[model samples]
Target: MQQMITLITNSISKDLPATLEKSLKKEISSLGPVIARAITPIIEKCSASAVADSIQKVVGDRVVNQLDKSVSAKLEATVARQIQMQFHTSVKQTLQDALRASLEAFLVPAFEQSCKTMFEQVDSAFQKGMSEHTVAIQQQVEATHTPLAQTLKDTISSASSITQNLTAELLDGHRKLLALLASGNAKAHSTNVLQPNNVPVTGPPEVEAPLDPMKELGRLISERKFDEAFTMALQRSDVSIVSWLCSQVDLRALCSMVPVPLNQGVLLALLQQLAVDIATDTPRKIQWMTDVAMAINPTDPVIAMHVKPIFEQVYNALLHLRSLPTTSPSDSTSIRLFMHVINSVLLSYK
Candidate 1:
């Protein structure tokens, strides 16, 4: 059977091409119309309603869905932006209120108190400084006032005497002028002169006496004749002449009266005199010490150490006086404290 099947396949394969060719020719001749007929109804149906209507429905639905999505997205974005802006505004307002409350509750009161304290401290310091200056000024004024008062009293007395002298001189001159008018000068100078009272006089003018030396000195000083007045005072034998002159003259002017590079001999003589005075007047020892202190112009201990000339001079004078045979050990001990007090004041300036 396998042999018979192989033989039949060979025979059919040999005849297949011829038969197939003939059949294709016949079918091909009728195939065009048949294909046209089969496809025409489907093309017509698609063109008439199915394809265009379905396409329109699908495109419209897609467009409507896309528009809805776009509108929804825009609305959502606007709402979100409004929400964000509202949230920021609300938070900003809240923070501002909190900051204002915190500052009012905490910082403002503390700052005001701090300012008040600073102002009070400044005011107190100013007052204290002013009070100290006022006290110092008052002390200086008191120290100088006695001499100034004496000078003023002397000036008033001198003025009264001058006025009396001038009155006597004027009356004498009037008598001489009347006598001249009565004798020879009246007609000669009458055209140039006016006589309001037209009263006659007969007495001759009297010569004026020379002024007192003290009065002359006072007048010279008042006239600013400082050098002449100072020389005059120095020449006077009066023990209180210097004190009287000091009442009228400035301390600087008095100091100027001493020759420059001050005469050490004169200074020593003055010191010796002061020492004698202080020794004799035991009650005024402290006052002498104060005068010495004023002359030294004391400074801090460090500065005093560097510039010790004046202090040394004062110390040597004190030492020399204390070493005198008249000074007892008890007196030396008591006087030693004055030096110590001066030294302490110098150190305190540091």
Candidate 2:
């Protein structure tokens, strides 16, 4: 019985634990179904939320960083380009302003004053000297008139040789007067002296004026009073005044000193006036125009305006002359020759 009890006791111990374990497993299995049903969705929800937060942080940081870098780079590049452009513009403007100021300060006024002084001095001296010389010549001529006439009559009565000699003497005196007048020494009392009807005075007479306007103009040009000289030339209406101005000026030299484009208008006007003089049948005028045209840029509008018409006129005149017979030269031939020379000279320019 005791041995049977021991075996039963040992078997009971093993069987009892096994049985309890089985019961426990069955109860846990039942509870697992409930737990799975209830807690599975909650756990999934929590895990999903955590994952979404992590992704949001990562993507937000990456996007934000990229945008910041792009914005910063673009702003920096824009600012640098703008600064460079502004700096370049400012430098160019400053340089132009400085150059303009320098020109205004030095050149214009000095030239004007020098011309005024030169004109005044020359005009005064020429008039004073001319007047004194005129008075002296008049007095000498009057004193010798009666005696000279009587001697001439007496000589003519005696011999044919004496009359011829007396005539020659009178002719020599007349020639002297013409010389004085041609030299601009004789008083231009009337514009009529230029006419064939008016007799000229033949004596050393002092002119009343102190200055010769022509000489004054020449002096101004030589001294480089270009602006003033040009102004004076334009103001004077006298053909002689214009002629003198054209004669004195060195057109090439004047053009060289003058700046282009800026002074082109003034220079062109001067050229136009010169062309008028040339067409007036003055060879010196033609020569002056040729010199001026050569000195200026060919593309210059003023030069083109002045020269193109002259070229056409001369070319047409030549064609007309060619059609005529080759006979003794007339005034028309002279005109044709002058035009031909003008055409040749103008073509040589530039």
Candidate 3:
């Protein structure tokens, strides 16, 4: 039976293609039935029980072998044709499609998951690169901005300092001018006489006249007549002379005279001069002015009369100086002297 099977396989191999070729290529439809009939004899040779088994074994083996060979030949021919057409067409696309379909079937959800993971990885890398680029740009901007900000701050600081210094100088100039005006007014308005105490009774041909009011005050101070000197200094409303005398006199003794009702105009004039002077000569003069101004009874008509005019004069002077486009050297010097006087008076009060 094995021999018969082998023989039938070989015969079928040889005749089947011939029958199919005749039917398919030559247009001979009768060859298929003829081939079927030829195989029937081999089927009959086996016994009824053995026929089915024998025919099944033999025909199955022959059919399987033929199918495999035909499929393999067709595949080879298709591959050869594809290789030839590959240069003319996009073969990679075809291969990719075929691979994708096959992998999809075999890998199922795992394949889909792998594709998603790959895409995420690529996206993450792109985002990381963009973030790094952004950071670099920001750092560059900060590098430029930091210096610019610092430069602007420095410029503002310098400008502010200049403004402050100029304002101070202008204020000082105004006070000096006002004090000079006040001094001139005082000299014109005052009826006080100038007397010298330390002069010699007899003099040479070239002998100078007696010391002026300022010199006499100095002599009195040197002689330790501080009270008399201070009183004498206050008598003359010369802001410059009075200011100098106050500086030389003992402040403790000077303060004791504050409560006494003297000429308030003279006192206020003295204070105004001191205010201007202290602002320049000594910064602490403002405090002194505050103290002395406070010490004076605000209700006193005399104090008010004196304070009001001086305050108005000083205020007007400051406004005038501030409004002026330019200041002269003489005006500048006068302002300095006034400031010195104001400083000394205020210091005495403090």
**Best prediction by TM-score:** 1
Q: Judged by lDDT relative to the true structure, which candidate is superior, 1 or 3?
A: 3
Clashes of 1: 0
The per-residue C-alpha lDDT of model 3 at residue 126 equals: 95
Candidate 2 per-residue C-alpha lDDT over 1-350 given as tens digits, one digit per residue, 9 for 90 to 100: 99999999998898988988999999999999899999989999998998888887878788888999999999999999998888789976887888888767876578778888898998898889888888888888878887988886765455445334433433333233223333443233211121111334444332322267677677768787765565455434344565667666666556555363214333433444444323244445545545554454545533344445434443443344334343225534544565655566557654
- Quick one: ranking by TM-score, best first? 1, 3, 2
Q: Tell me each candidate's TM-score.
A: 0.31, 0.26, 0.28
> Which sequence of candidate numbers ranks them by lDDT, best first?
2, 3, 1
How many steric clashes does model 2 contain? 25
Give the Å error, residue 254, model 3. 2.1
lDDT of 2 at 53: 87
Estimate, for each residue in 175-269, the C-alpha lDDT of model 1 and write its tens digit. Answer: 33333333433332221121113344233322122257678778878887654454344333232553455456554434445342222222222
Give the better candidate number (2 or 3) by TM-score. Answer: 3
lDDT of 2 at 272: 42
Report the poorest 10 consecutive residues by lDDT, candidate 2: 189-198
lDDT of 3 by residue, 274-324 (tens): 544342544334434443454444344433334444544444443344333
